[model samples]
Target: MTRVLVPLLRASCPPGAGGYGGSIELRLPDSEAERLGGVALVRAALRAAARELGWKAETFGWTGTIHGTMVGVTDRRTPPAPFDSVVDADRQRRMRDAVDRVGRPGTPSLPPTDEPSARLPTEEFLTAYAAAQGVVDR
Candidate 1:
């Protein structure tokens, strides 16, 4: 039987701050995202986060928009981010750069065994992002 891996991203940002959130669902089987690379997955996650944020704004009747910074990733079935908080401004640029640099095509290579696999480039970017976020280990 195929295992179901739910990869989620977490985020923290102020109004107008820009960034993406963690992905909690991979939506495999029928979802085309499964066929795409980690970069694509990240992109989709970002879009979803943005939409959700927008929804929240509408829900509260707030005219101000919000942005985000990924605090960490989660797998429900697996451990999620160890730390959770808002990413600073300087680190934000690095995060943006890392995501931008991960445009190369390929699926993220989950760590061997029950580990998560992200495309090589995407993996590298995430590592850098984690570091920038002051992550010492997974």
Candidate 2:
């Protein structure tokens, strides 16, 4: 399992205006993130943490859009498996083709299309994501 440390960005409260808040470190399962469900699970954890801490956090940067106004953490390591697995080879190829076409240099292309779908996690992925988040899976 890979671990990610996300840093929280604090909003400036006027000088000397103190508040009971600080950055937090979130450790997430590296394996799950490659899969769609993994992303959703991690996002949920971040949201819960923010709510409990009374802070508005936005997950941005390497970790992707996890939520609104929350801190996101990521280690530069990409795990193997599902991320490299070709469950839908044809679809994956098509997606790549589309990206290549649009990414052509000097070519003004349309924005990428959003494919709404659910992520199905492998048992291993689920287990790892849960453990990393410290959630008790009963």
lDDT of each: 0.33, 0.39
In model 1, the worst 10-residue window by lDDT is 55-64
Top TM-score model? 2
lDDT (10s digit) by residue, model 2, range 11-96: 21112223222233333335435443455555655555444444555544234435222224222222235432332343355567
After TM-score superposition, the amount by which residue 78's alpha carbon in candidate 1 deviates from its true location, in angstroms, is: 36
TM-score of each: 0.20, 0.27
Worst 10 residues of 2 by lDDT: 5-14
lDDT of 1 at 38: 36
For model 2, what is the C-alpha lDDT against the true structure? 0.39
Candidate with top lDDT is 2
